[model samples]
Target chain A: MIPVLGGSGPVIPSFGSGSSCEQNNGWWCTDWLREHWGDTLQPALVQHIELVAIAIAAGFLIASVLAIAGFRYRLLDVPVGGFADFLYTIPSIALFQLLVPFTGLTVLTVEIALTSYTLFVLYRNMVAGLRGVPEDALEAARGMGLTRVQTFFRVELPLASPAVLAGLRIATVSTVSIATVAAFVVPKGLGEPIFIGLDQNLFKTEILAAGGLAILLALAADVALAWFARAVTPWSRA
Target chain B: MSVLADQFTAHTFVDAFRFIGDNASLMLSKTGQTCELAFAALGIALALALPLGLWLGHRHRGLFLALGVSTLGRALPIIVLIAFGLTVLGVGFWNNTAALVVLGIPPILTNAYFAVDGADRDAVEAARGMGLTERQVLLRIELPLGLPLIVAGVRISAVFVIASATIAAIAGGGGLGDIIVNQASYGLAGVIAGSLCVSAVALLTALALGLVHRAVSRSTTARA
Candidate 1:
């Protein structure tokens, strides 16, 4: 086990040499990273990515199903959007507390909340994309004797790809961000380092490194997603 | 029943009310503090983002910049920003507010830029042709045309800031979150009470702004 940090014993601040090293190092140092990477930093980063990946994947799946349902039944859009917005309005901390008793401090609790957060972004974008498909294109597909399913898969889906890609990028970024707070619920990810940094008064280096890494992760993921979007939607350039 | 008996023996709503009543002063101050943090952030973000976005959109430049910023801002998590703020600036109002200000900026900037960029081109050209200076054209035409989306952006930021301000308590800046965060000592009733207040405030703020957004867009559409 990679030391959960808080369940038992007093928090032993073992990573760094001392405050003097931090002060001398000034904010972020390569030396400090080398010192901690094998044990603390790498694991936290991996876990952070894992949490974000799982939540976003799960969220995208659920949102896709819901979005399709809403699109198929126009009346479902209102209630679906409203419910997602309601879930979005709930403060993250409160949501965690509300779930902790029932879920008892599990990753499932974090995933549920994180997944719920993605629905509004994903569903709205998906619906909008589907709706925004040019009517002429749909008509042409029908004129070509394509069935509704064929028209949808060939004409509508390709047209909707850009919007869906945009939604996926948004959902991924937001999930990465929110998963940081999941440390409070379960001591897993960069959040663990953050809380430990705050609690242990290991202020400068630890928090900076952890927080900076999280930001970097987000930026990197975003850039990658944007690149992927462009590559996948080659027609968008024209 | 005696006052003490009544106070001790209470249901969830009664306990919630008692928690509110007992900490009435703290709740009020914290609520104000949270509002100040959120509003201050919105104010600063508006000051910085609006003009830049408007100018870029007016000149038909910086589309890439605007897009990059919106994407980047979404990627940066609120909690990490808060942690970074605390590390860089120490635990204070500035630290908490800085994080929130960053949070509020992208939507306002992106919307403002797109609003100007997407304004009716013919109206803008006509205004310019009819002896209006660039500044005047922007002020008289683009600004009005863009007002609906700009306000919608602010509304989004405001609601987001209000909801995220609860994290300020964790950062040691007092807010309604203080109640929920301190639920260890304040108990389950305090959590329920504080959460209700946060949710209500978030929903109410969003609802009010939503109404304003609709009115602005509706009037603009009517004019068009």
Candidate 2:
């Protein structure tokens, strides 16, 4: 996702990522991070959160719309689903390069990429969620003289809520991990810290430390998401 | 036909041939590299994770957690692992292969654990009541019962590992990904050739695994 478009570098959130303390404070890659690890943590964590938040918000809304359309009309499923599959097949790096011209390497670019990813897994889950509504329930709602819209809101959505939440949890964890790549283009977040560590080609220990932290963040996200999933669905025990 | 269209069509075909000719030797070695990485990782995954998985299934029934955790590997993309591994351990085949193994482990481990745990609990009890030791029960009843699931998981893991191993080639892991990346700069021919290499490895491994799965599953099914 190296920036190749016309404009500023990646659309990282408001955070100072470009400055290097190596020269000013002789932090080098290694000790610089150690000396000011707290300084790096805020920006990286912020960037990470921003990337994930943007991605999930966009993805779920779009996926929900698509799911509704698909549920209403079966014919739209193949064409739209096929296209989503196509997006999923293309490597993340290649897709980013192609979009750089339009999105200009910002949070928007990363958001779109991460959102597209969520589609592959989340769309299926969304379909499953919607399809899971019992037909008898729908018929009962119909017999009660409820409109299609009302049935969907009351009978369908509530029944599908757990499945949708499960899908959201999966999408959340997936987005958090995938969002790391946004740092390849953008200027903010933990990715920048890790990328800078990789790029400067200095501070081996410091880079390793960053790497360890990234993995830790990844594990933490997994646990938190698992907790969230369990909270939403008491039946889905590990 | 317009000469431009004809020439373009001819160019695509010729480019395809030339790409294959140019990378024939490189393709073979690269294929070997990917195969070696996939197979070795499969072996290691089986050795390290399979027994543990089976044990978890049999003992306190912790395999479910193993299955849940392994799902993490599947959720994350292999490309990211390749990228991260390159930075962490410099760039080379060993590191790439190691990363592939790490990526490959979850599926195999999950399958092994579940298959063993899901083995006919009745038969397991029968074997136990017959005065069989835990090890004997596992070796004779559990292993044989769980063989199908374990094999199926291995097959799936093998295919995934092979496909993923291509990305490792980017970091000089010496596989089809090298071809994919190499010819990618060359245009359509490079893309086709590299794609072919990846597809070949994936499909071939998948087919082999399928055969293995069928044999193992059939035996287990017959026993049941």
| Backbone Cα, N, C clashes tallied per candidate | 0, 9
Q: With candidate 1 superimposed using the best TM-score fit, by how many Å does residue B132's alpha carbon deviate from the native?
A: 1.6
Q: Write the per-residue lDDT of candidate 2 for residues B179-200, one digit (tens) a residue.
A: 4544325554554555566556
Q: What share of the true interface contacts does candidate 2 keep?
A: 0.04
In candidate 2, position B69 carries an lDDT of 61
User: How much lDDT does candidate 1 score?
Assistant: 0.81
- Give me the runs in candidate 2 sitting further than 4 Å from their true place: A1-31, A34-41, A62-91, A94-112, A127-160, A183-189, A234-238, B1-29, B63-68, B71-91, B118-160, B163-170, B179-200, B203-215
Candidate 2 residue-wise lDDT, A88-206, digit = tens: 54445334433454566566767788889888667777878888888899899999999988998988987787788777776776566656556655766555665565555433444
DockQ (CA atoms), all models:
0.36, 0.13
Native interface contact recovery, all models: 0.47, 0.04
Q: Whose DockQ is greatest here?
A: 1
Winner by lDDT: 1
Quote each prediction's TM-score. 0.88, 0.69
